[model samples]
Target: MSTIFLAVGLVLVVEGLAYALAPSFIRRMAEELPKLADEYLRIFGVAALAVGVGLVYLAQHL
Candidate 1:
């Protein structure tokens, strides 16, 4: 649908801007991710994945 296309396009735009403006910060975050404790990292990853799935479900229904 047009709305889905627009949403995807906006996401790409924002992501591109972030990469252009803060590439080093992004890399630093990635590099430091492994330093996080396993349990805490797993919890954070699972919560983020769950939230992403919930957003997709809501987008489809709405």
Candidate 2:
């Protein structure tokens, strides 16, 4: 569906911008990611997922 494509495109744009604008910061995060505790990463990922779902819900309703 068009909505799915739009979501993917928007994600790519945002991700690309981050890499383009701050390649060093991105690399640093990637390098440190493996050193982070698994539980901490899992919690952060779930929180991000919740925020993403909230944004999608708002976009649809508002």
Candidate 3:
């Protein structure tokens, strides 16, 4: 339980830093997302989904 909480807390801290310090970068990325080719976009989406799933699995295991 403590491990899970630590994992979630770490994720939140990193995300919060991004939100606080790189809002423009995030916005730019979002704006540019649609300009990516369909295949590349699909690949990026899949990779992100996989990473997210892996993180959740690790958190659970921890």
Candidate 4:
């Protein structure tokens, strides 16, 4: 659907902007990620997923 494509495009745009504007920060995050614990990363992933789902739900209903 067009909505799906738009969402993907927006995500890519934001990701690109981060790398473009803060290349050093992005590299630092990538370097630090390998040192992060698996459990911590898992929790972060879950939190991000929850936030994303909540946003989509609100976008559709509101």
- Predicted model with the maximum TM-score: 2
Q: Score each candidate by Cα lDDT.
A: 0.91, 0.99, 0.90, 0.97
> Model 4: per-residue lDDT, tens digit, 1-62?
99999899989999999999999999999999999999999999999999999999999999
Model 1 spans with C-alpha error above 4 angstroms = 1-17
Per-residue lDDT for 1-62 in model 1, tens only? 99779878988998999999999999999999989999999999999889877988898899
- Candidate 2 per-residue lDDT over residues 23-62, each given as its tens digit: 9999999999999999999999999999999999999999
State each candidate's clash count.
0, 0, 0, 0
Flag the better candidate by lDDT, 1 or 3: 1
lDDT of 3 at 16: 98
The TM-scores of all predictions, comma-separated, are 0.63, 0.97, 0.60, 0.94
Per-residue lDDT tens digits for candidate 3, residues 1-62, read 98679878988999999989999999999999888899998998899989988978986799
Candidate 3 ranges beyond 4 A from true positions: 1-16
Give the better candidate number (2 or 4) by TM-score.
2
Q: Indicate the residue-level lDDT of 15 in model 1.
A: 90
Model 3 score (lDDT): 0.90
Score residue 28 of candidate 3 by CA lDDT.
99
Error (Å) of candidate 4 at residue 13 is 1.0
Poorest 10 consecutive residues by lDDT, candidate 4:
6-15
